[model samples]
Structures are given as C-alpha cells and as structure tokens.
Target: MQFDFSARQLITRLIFWLSVSSFVGYLIGHVWAAMTLVSVSLLIWHYLHLNKLVTWLWNSKSLSPPMAEGGWGRIYDGLYHLIRKHRNKQKALNERIRRFRDGAEALPDAALVLSNDLTILWGNKKAQNLIGIQWPGDVGQRIDNLIRFPEFAKYLEAGNFESPCNVPSPLDAEKQLELRMMAYGSDQVLFLARDISKVHRLEEMRRDFVANVSHELKTPLTVVRGYVEMIQLAENDFSPQWLKAFSTIEGQVSRMDRLVEQLLVLSKVEVNSDVENSDIVNMPEMLGQLIEDSQWLNVDKKHEITFDIAPDIAMLGSDTELKSACSNLLSNAIGYTPENGKIHVSWQYDGERAKFSVTDNGPGIKAVDVARLTERFYRVDKSRSRDTGGSGLGLAIVKHVVSHHHGELVIKSDWGKGSEFSIYFPNEVISSLKN
Candidate 1:
C-alpha cells in the first residue's frame, strides 16, 4: 500500500510549466500572467512531491524516519524513550555483574559454583590455587572428573540438600583441606573448602594424651594395691626383714600417692575453666622452701643443692600449683643426681620474661628421648625412674602448667652433660603483677 515518485515525472512537470507560461503569454498578451501561472503550477507540483517523499521515507525498512506531528507521533516518541530506559538498566546490571565477579575472585577460601549436572560453572582465585585448575579450561568440566573422590561424587549424586558432605584432600596432596558441598539454588551447588588438618591433629593429640594418662594412673594404682594387700595379709608373721620389706612397700605407696595428686592437679589445669584465683607468688621465697624440702627428702643420699635466685623475682599463679611444679622439678633432680652431685635452682629476668631453670648434674637425656620427655609416663630409663620413686608425670605436669599460662618450657642437654629445664613465663604477666 505504498507509492514512490520517479525523477522523470518531476522533469516532465518542469517542462509543462514552461510550455504553459508560453501559451499564457501568447493569449493574454501579458508577461505577469504567464509568470503567475508558472509559479502556481510549480507550487502544486512541489507540495505533491513533498508528500510522496515523506511517505517513501516512513515506509522504508532500512531507515527509521522522524515521527509525524500528532497523537501517533507522541506514542512513537514514548516507545523510543522506553527503549532507551531499558538499555540504561541493562548497562547497570552488567556493571554489577562485573563487580560481583571481581569480589568472588579475591576471596581466600576455595569457592566453586556448580551446575545441576555437577559441572563447574565458575571458580575463584583460591579454588585455582587449591585445586590446580586453569581458569578458562576448568569451566564446564565435570566436578567428579576434577575432584576424583568417590565419597564426594556419591554425595553430589545423592541430591541431599539438607546436609553437606566433606571431601578430604587427595593422596600426595600439597595442601590439606576439607570440602563441603551444599545446594545453593534451584539448579546450582556451592562447594566450600577449608584447611582443617591442624584441627584434626589437635583432636588426635588430645585423645592420645587422655589414653596415656589413664594407662599411667592404672599401672601405679595396681602396683600400690598389690603391695598393700601383701603387707596386710603377712603383718602378724612379719620378722625384722619382713618389717624392712613393709617399709619399702610403704615408700612405693607414698610415691603412688604423689603421682595421683599430680594427676589431679594436671586435670584441673587442663579443664575448660578460668584459672583466675591465683596469688602473686614470691619466686625467691618459694625456691628457698623447695631447697629445704629437697634437703629433707635427700637426707639419706646427701646430695648437694645450690640456689642462684635473682632478687625480687615474682610470678602470678596458684601458690600451691607453682610450688608443686617447682618441687617436682627439684625432687626429680635430687632423686636422679648421684650422691655429692650438684642440683642448681636459678631465677632471672630475660628482658621482660621470667626464666626459672633447674640444672642437675645427673645422667643426661639421650638426644632421641628429649622430644618425648614431656609426654606422660614417657621415661628414658623406666627401671631407674621406678627405683627412684619418680611418678614419670613430673615433666608432663610442668609442660601442662607452662602451656596453661601461655608460656614455654625448653629442655637443653648433651649426652654426657647434665640437663637444664627452663620455664619461661610471659612478660605481660610479670608487668601486670608489678603494676
């Protein structure tokens, strides 16, 4: 329903106008009359041509013509405004998407977005680092192909959205991690990975420590009970030699008692509770008391004791606990050292930290055994430890106390030279007590 005018028709109209003007001049005998006829005809032709040009431009498919002047034109202009608005909105949406991608790339934990078919859609920086994935190459790859864990593959196939499944690191892996998968959207899954090896190791250590403690306590109690029963049953028929044996049995019983007491103290310190009810213990005074106690305990052996305490050194801890810890260290030293050998107790402030050290001229620990010396019931010479009435829990208790106070315990010894046990308390504790 459209029409177009040709250039030939426009040329014919010009020729007709010139001819009409010549005819009018011959009839009317006036040049003005001929010019007026020529002007009117040309005006009519130009108006008709203008209409045709406008229709052709509007009907053309290749170019968008300007709107007409009326109600239809207003509607066309409204549509144009709506199209521009949509374009602006789309541009804003794209910008937000770019920003979101940048943020996801910067995250530290390994994060992956998976499609419904268990294919990886996208992965972050940490994912690439942890999983050894190449960016463009990894997208659209099946997750099961990359992870290669049977349990995780089964977990994804199970379609359980309520609970997450853990995927452990692969064998011979560099970084150890635990991956958890959860359904995030209608057709998507989110995979999160975290490093939990340290936590796992800590849990294992706790279990081992508990088992060792139980075993240690059970052995001593069994021995002590057996000796008590023997002494009670043969009391009436006991001679002087039997009486001496009874005294030895009593010594073993006393050693067991000390072991039980130390175990209780260690248990209390390790419990999940605040240890705030402590006193400002004077180190010099406590050392003096320990020396006196050691002298009495070593009366028969006659071991030499030495003290080199720094003046005015103090510590913040339970008076009974600290005294017990120090006493155990000194007692072990006195019990192990040969007669007339030296046992030295010294105190000094290294910078702001306080160091309490006990050095003994005893048979030193072997290089290999030093690592496990602080473990409960771990004795280098089991027979010697039993004979000297050592509970084998002394160093273990010292280690627990030092850890509880956020401190460090260091043991230095050569194969031939004596061992030095140093307990370092944090400087903050000392400064707080001073203030």
Candidate 2:
C-alpha cells in the first residue's frame, strides 16, 4: 500500500515534537520528563489524524459524494454520461442520414453513387427499375459489369465531366437514355439518368414530316412549271379562248411558285436559324423592300398603304427571312383591307426591344380563330384568301421565322375593328445604335 503523506512532511512533524519534548523536560524538574513523554504521545496522535485526512482527500476512491443525489457518485459516472451522450448524438446523425437517403431514393430519375473505381456504392429505386439493379447485391458491382455498352464504358473511362453524354438503355433495347456524371464528394461520383425515347421519336417525326412535304411539293411544282413553259411556247397555235385558259393556268402557276418559295424559305429558316452564318438583317431596308413589294401587290386592288418607320431600327437575323416574314404580313394586310382602306406599317425601338406592327382596317379576325391562324393551311376566309392569291402559309412562315429568331409574334384583333400584328425582337438581336 502507498502512503499519501510525503517523507519531508512526516520528518518535519517528528522534529517539531522532539524539540517541544526536550524543552519541557528542561523547564520542569523530574515531573518535566513525564509531562514531555505525554506531550510527545499527543503530538504523534494529532499527526496521525492529519495524515488520515490528507489520505482521504487525495485518494478519490475512498470518499463518496456529499449527497449521493446531485453530485457524481463515482469517477465512472463521468465516463458513463459521456458514453450515453455520444450514443444519442450518433443516433441523431444516423436518423438524419437515413432521411437524406430516403429522399434521394424517391426521386423520379435514376441515381447512382459510385466510387472512383466505377463500383456502385448506392442506388435508388428508379435506378434499379431502369438498370436492373438488385439492392445490396448490386452495391459492389462494377459499372461496366452492370451496363454492358462499349460507348458508355468508354465515356466512363475517359472521365470527361464537361457535359452529359447519352447512352442506350440496357433494360430496353429500343429505348434511349441521357446519362450525366457529376463529381459528388471525395473519391465519389454521381450518375443521373433520364429517359429520352419520347423526345427522340418526336424529333424523328418532325424531320420526316418536313422531308415528305418538301418532296411532295417539289414534284407537283416541277410539273406545273413545265406545263406553263409548254403553254407559253404554244401560244400562237391556240385560240382566243385557249389564251383565256392559259391566263388561268398562268395564275395557278404563279400561286404554285409562291408556295414553293415560301416552303423553301421555311425550310431554310428551320435549318440555318440556329447557325452562325445567318446575317444581321437591317429592319429599315427590309421594311423598305417589303413596302415596295406591297405597292406592287396593291396596284391590282388600288389599296391605300402607309409606312411609319423608326430610323435605323435593325435586328440580327437572316435578311431574306425577315423580308419574307414582313412581306407576308404586309400582303395579308393589303389583301384583307377593302379598296381605299388605310393600312399602316409602323416600327419602333424601345431600349431593350424593337417592335414592328402591321395594322389594317379590314374584316378583322375573330378571337376564336386567332389561335389557329398560325397553323399551316389554316385560313379564316379560305375562299377570299384563295381568290386574293394567298397560299394560306404566310402566317405559318411568319410564326416559324419569329420563333427561330427568339422573337415574339402577337396578333390583336376585334371582329370588325381590324387587326394589328406586332412582332418584338429581343435586344440580343439588336444591341446598340450605330451612328
């Protein structure tokens, strides 16, 4: 057993008592010696009491808590409390992690957390449904082992994270998917996948429709042009009545020509609108050309036309396309307006946008028909449109051109108050004024 008191303390107490006993023995005669012995014994007893108190204070295990109710019962109590708090904190952290996992798993798109070595660490329910994964069984499986596409495997190995890549679905042979990879945390990656089969199908259908229409129109147009040339060459051989018949044929031929032209313009706009070679069209010059073209058309009906142009209001787009769009709008305005009716072509430039409006005093479009006006071959007054040499595709072409250039085409009309067609081009197409 170890003594709590130091050797120096014990020795100091012993020396003090020895000096007291010797002084007492010298002061009294024979009785002094007996009193000195008793005093020495009492000093020894007091020293023992002090030693016991020091030992009790220093030796922690020997003493209990003052109340045993409030203070810690033992040193182990601190350790037990620390352990319990740690367990509670760990349980809370685990619950939070579980909540996060549950939320991630419920997402619609397939999600997979993968390691740098391409092993899948975790996957959501959607991922299992899409990629045929079986819970914990598929956890440690390599991505290549699960997804057996050379293109996807190559993409993963390349490690280029600039943009997402598309891959064929392993679950369905006919379906396609878009796969995107993101660096999530240290040594971990996330793969997100979405189904794009419907989008691909729609795109394919659009291309086919355009191609079919172009081919069908091209054949008819070629035949009509050929017959017109034959009729022109054989004019002398035909009667006066044949000449009138030729005039009718010529009108129809002209309509066909206009149809072909519009079709070509629409096709070109669709293909090249998003490309860089498209030029910045000067709106004033284009509108000037449109005005001149409208006057030529107006000569047949003797309609009154006016222009309210803002100087140097330019837009970035194909010159041909804008001219075609403007000409179509102007022609429609002129066609619907009665003789001597006023038609206004106005242009204005706000700080952020440029707008062109073609207003006419004519039998305006009804509200119910305005929504369908931009559809191909949709005409409010088909007989009037056909008689006025309209191809029923002018508004469709205008809508397509406006949409391609990221512009807005709005039509405001009342039953009899006339119609106003406004086109707004964003500032991205028309930046700053040039002096």
Candidate 3:
C-alpha cells in the first residue's frame, strides 16, 4: 500500500536512517564513511524514481501509476488522477461538438460559416446540393468568388443583412434561392441559402392573374359606365327618387373603375422586376405639374397647398412611373386632409441624395397603422376612406416604385398631429444637377 509521503514524514525517516548509520559507524570507528554511503544510496534511489517519472510522462500509454514507495508513489498516484479527470472532460467536450455538427448537417437549408473576410470556413451537404459549393475544395475559397451574380456580390459587399437577397440559382436558371447573412461569433458570419422557387412561382402566378382579370374587367366596366352616363343624360324624364338612385349608381361605377385602373398599374409595376434607368426624369417639372393637378383636386377641400420644388433636379428613371408615384402622394394629401388644412410639398437634392416629401396637417395616422400603410386595401378609417374615394393602392404603388428605383419610402406621422410621406433617391440615380 502506498502512503501519502508528506515532507515532514520523509524528513523524519531520513533522520532515523542517519542516526542508525552513525551509530554503526561510531562502533566501527568510520562514522563519516558510513554517512556518505547512506547519502549516496538515498540519492540513487531518488534518481531512479525521477527517471521513471520522466519516462511515464514522455511515452507511457497506460494510466496506471508507476510503482514506488513513500513520496514518489504518492506523486505518481496524484498525476494519474489528474490526467484521468482531464481526459474525461475532453471526451465529453468532443461529444458535444459532434452532436452540434450533426444537427447543423441535418438542417434543410444550406448553412455556411464564413470568416469576416467572407472566406468559406465550413458548410454542410445542402450547400453543395443547393448552390454548388463543394466541400473540402471550396472550404478555403472566398464566397464571392464562387457565387458570381452581380446582385449577390453587391449585397455581400454592402454589408447590409437586414433584408435577404433573392436571386436565381447559379446552378439552374429556373430555380430561385433566397440568401441571408447574419452575424455569428466575433467577426464571423453565418450564411444561409433557401430554395424559394415555389414561393417565387406563386407570386408570379398571382401577379399574372391580377393583370389578366383587370384587363378583362376593363371592357365591361367601360360599357357599364357609358350606359350610366347615357341614363344620366335623360334625368329630366325620371322621378326624383330614380334620379338620386341613378346618381349613386354612377358614383359606385366610378369608384370601381378607379379601383380596376389602380390594380392594373400595380400589377404592371410588380411584373417588371427591374426598371429601365436610361430615361432621365425631370423632378422639378414633374412635381410642378402634379402640384397644379393637386390644387385642382383640392378645390372643394380648400386645403392651403404649398410646394418648394428645387429647379433642374434630374434622375435616371421611368418618367411615367415617377409621375404616377408623385401624383398619388399629392392627391392622397389633398383627399385625406381636413378642410382648410395645410399641405406642404418639397423636392430637394443636396448632392448626395434627392428627396420628395409631402407634409400635411391632417388627422395623422396612428403608430400601428403607419407600418401597414403600404399594404394594399389597408385603411386607418375604412368608412372615411370610402368617402374620400381612396382605393388604398396609392401608397402600395409608391412603395413598389421607390423599390424599383432602388430608393426608400419613409412615412412619419403622429396621431392627431400631422404626417409626412417622403421618398429618397440614392445619389447613384441622380443623373444631373444645377444649382
């Protein structure tokens, strides 16, 4: 059995051996020689144990402690226990890592770990199946080099991950993939790619259905409206109640016509994913014409309309789409604001960006409603919206237009106070400027 060899016990044992050796030497008249022999023997014993310990540390595969007595045995036992604990902990840690890797591999979406510099550090099999990222070979390559789409490259370079980038698959043109990036560990990014071909196809089908239905309804609506107008021309022959009924019918027909027209416009914008940026748009001229039209529409409301348009502000965009977007905003302000309310419109280009804003002192929208303002058919007050003849497609059209031009639509409003609708165009779209 090995006893714990404390320093005190070892010292006591040495003292006893020395005393016994000295006693023998004194009897034989060789005390110094006996003591030297004892010391040398003790030194040799310690040297042998020290060599055994060094060998165990360097090359021993077994956890069993080397046999010894007293202090050396105790030291061996201590080392064996320490190494065993460390090995067990390491084994548990490795098991956890294996489980995590297995879970990641089983995910349906393609997942990749990337360094800050966008180097592909690791990816699962789905990455290969979805985006053609081969394992082992592509691990050290930069992700941008593998996915060469201009939109995808620009999105990665911009470092903005708030919105996912939707692009056609590089491997197959018919397939669609939505790519998202998120911050992972320090200075690392987690990239995810999902197959969204079905979702994309469904969206396209919906747009096509809306466009076709709107086209079909147009002829019938025109015929009905023409007949209603013809009947109104003979109001003198009808009774008072009949005349009033005919008037209501005409108003409803007009509202329906407006709704169908707006739907066609929205579908057209949605179908065209990219805009033609070749045509230069004169912001000052376009907004000036819209303000005039707005004043004419506001004759009944008598809202104090004002505009501050900067001259010669130009950008590359579709003139027709820009006019539709600007017209909607101005007309919305005139329609929604209370009578005698103040409306202000401004167009400004400060070299970096150009902005068009319409501010109105009307019944401002609530905080919750502001977020859903751009949703088609969403209205803060449904009954009031009907009275104002709002088809609820105006803001939706404006949003799509701004997105198509790679711009932002910002709406700021406070309940019971006022609201401002602003569209900002990035400097890249600005084609010319004059002070």
Best by lDDT: 3
For candidate 2, lDDT tens digit of each residue in 1-435? Answer: 222446687678666766766676667655467556867687676666556445545674533322222122332344445656787999999999899789988777889889988789988888877777756789899977988887687677767777566677888977888888898898999888888889877866785576568768877877877887788788898898988887888788778777767766665665564534246667777788778866777886787777888877777777777787888898899888888788999989855888889998888999999999988778888899888877778888898788767788999998998999999988777743477
lDDT of 3 by residue, 166-231 (tens): 988879989999999999989989999999999999999998998899899999988988988898
Clashes of each: 0, 0, 0
Structural RMSD, model 3: 2.9
lDDT for 113 (candidate 3): 93
Q: How close is candidate 2 to the true structure, as a TM-score?
A: 0.55
Candidate no. 3 TM-score: 0.90
Error of 1 at 67 (Å): 42
lDDT value, residue 138 of candidate 1:
91
What is residue 316's positional error in candidate 1, in angstroms?
2.2
Q: Whose lDDT is higher: candidate 1's or candidate 3's?
A: 3
lDDT of each: 0.73, 0.77, 0.90
- Which ranges in model 3 have alpha carbons more than 4 Å from their true place? 1-40, 134-137, 433-435
Alpha carbon deviation, residue 175, candidate 2 (Å)? 7.8
